[model samples]
Target: MKSLMPYLKARTVEELWEYHTKLMQSYGFDRLIYAYTCFQSAQSLTNPEDALILTNYPSEYIEAYIGHGLFRDAPMMKWASRNVGAISWRYMWDDPDNTPLGATRRELMALNKRFGITCGYTISFPMAIKRSAAGIGLVARAGMTQNDVDALWEDKGEELEIINQVAHLAITQLPATGQSRILTPRQSEVLELVADGKSVRDIALLLGRKVATVDKHLRGARESLGVETTAQAVRKASVLNQIFIVDPGTQLS
Candidate 1:
C-alpha cells in the first residue's frame, strides 16, 4: 500500500487510474471492474454517463451485459448494493441449493467463465457520504481457485481494502466527464440564482430580462442537466461544479 501513495497523489485522473490498475495486477488480479455512483436512487441507477466506471474487461462482453440488462439481475451486483464488505463468488455459486442461483444469474456466470472470470473477490466500499457507493471486483487469473483467492485475502485483505477505499474517495473528487450536455453560461446563471432562492420573477427582474426569457433559461438548465425539476438541476449542477465558482477578476453585480 505504501507503494501506492505516490500514485494516489497523481495530478491527473488518467494517471491515477493507470497506477491503480498496476497495483491491482500485482495482487494476482489480472482484470478489474470498478464503478461508483453519487446519485443512485430507489427508482434507478444513476445515468452511466454520470458515473465513473473503469474496467479492463472486453468491450464486447460489456456491451452484451448491458444490452441484455444482465446487470439488473447479477448476483454480485445485488450483493454489493446492500452489503459493504468483501464477498467471494464461490460462496454465491459453489452451493447452489443454499445460495439458489437463478437461471439468468447462472447464465451470466457461465458467460463470465468463458472469459476466465470464474473466481474472484468483490469489495463494496462503505459509503463515505449519503447517496453514494462504490465497489470493485478483482478477477483472478485463469485456473485460480476459490481457496487460492481466500489465502491471498487472508494475507493482504486489510491493505487491499484500504487501497480501494482511498481510490473511491479520490475518484469522487475528480470532475464528471462525458456528460450528455454542458450547461450554457446563461443557463448556469439562471440556476445559480435559483439556488440562491430567487424566484423566476426575481431572476427576471435582477437580470433585466423578460420573465419568459428567465423561464426559458431555467428550462434549458434542467434539460442540459437531464433533470425534471429546477431543484434537481441545482443539485446536479452543484455536484458537477457548474455554478458557484467565484472568479477573481469578475465582480458580482
Candidate 2:
C-alpha cells in the first residue's frame, strides 16, 4: 500500500483523482466516481456546478447519469448521504429488511449493470463544514461480485479507507477546476479585487481600466462562477481557489 503522504501532498484535483483511481484499481475495484460539495441540502447537492466531481466511468454513462441528474437518486449516493464510512454495494439488496431498495434504485441498479458496475463499495468521508459532504463510489471490475469485494474488504478495508479519506482531504485543499467555467486571469483578478473591498470605480483606477470595463469584468466573473451577484462570485471563487491563489506571479492574462 502507498503511503498517505503522497495523497496529502497532491497539488491538483485532477492529479489526485488520477492517482486514487489507479490505486483503487490495484485493489480490484476499477471504476470510480468521487464527489464533494459544500452546498449539500436535505433535497440534493444544490448547484451541481459548485461540487467537485471526478470519475473514470464510461463517458456515455457519465453523460447519461450526470447530464440527466440521475446521481441524486443513485443507491450508493443515497446511502452515503445519510451515513459515513465504507459500505458494500450489497447493502442495497442483500438485507432489504433494514432499508428496502425503492423502484428508482432498482432501475438505477439496472442502468449501472449495463455499464458493468454491479458490485463495489462507497466510502463517505466525514465532513466538518456545515451542509458539506464528500464521498466516492468504487465499482468492482467486471466478473467480480460483492462477495469478492467483501472478502477484500475484510482484509484491507482499513488501508483503503484511509487512502480515500486522505485523498478527499487533499481535494478540498486544491482548486476544483473540473467544470467548463474555469476563471480566466482577468476574472480571477476582478474577484480578488472585489474580495479586497474594492468598488468597481476603485478597481478601474487600480487596473487602469474604465468603470464600465470593470463592471463588465465583474459580470463576466459572475457568469463564470454561475452566481447571480459579485459577492456570491467572490465567495464561490474563494472556496474554489480561483482568487488569491498561492502563485499570483504566474497568473498572466
> Which candidate ranks first by TM-score, i.e. highest?
2
Alpha-carbon deviation at 240 in model 2, angstroms: 2.5
Tell me model 2's lDDT, rounded to 2 decimals.
0.80
Question: lDDT tens string, model 2, 1-253?
Answer: 7767767666677777888888899999889998887777777655568777889998998877888777766767777777889898887555323667677667677788799888889999988887778899988898888899999999999999988888877777777746423788888898898899988989999999999998988898888878898988887787677877665235467
Clashes of each: 0, 0
Model 2: colliding residue pairs: none
Instruction: Summarize candidate 1's per-residue lDDT along 1-253 as a digit string, tens digits.
Output: 5575755565445567777878888888888888776677776555655556778789877776655767666667667767799988776554422656687787788878778777889999888567766798888887789799989999998998888788767755554434413788789898899989999999999999999999999888888777899998888787665777544356689
Worst 10 residues of 2 by lDDT: 92-101
Query: TM-score of every model?
Result: 0.78, 0.86
Per-model root-mean-square deviation over C-alphas: 4.3, 3.5
Candidate 2 root-mean-square deviation in Å: 3.5
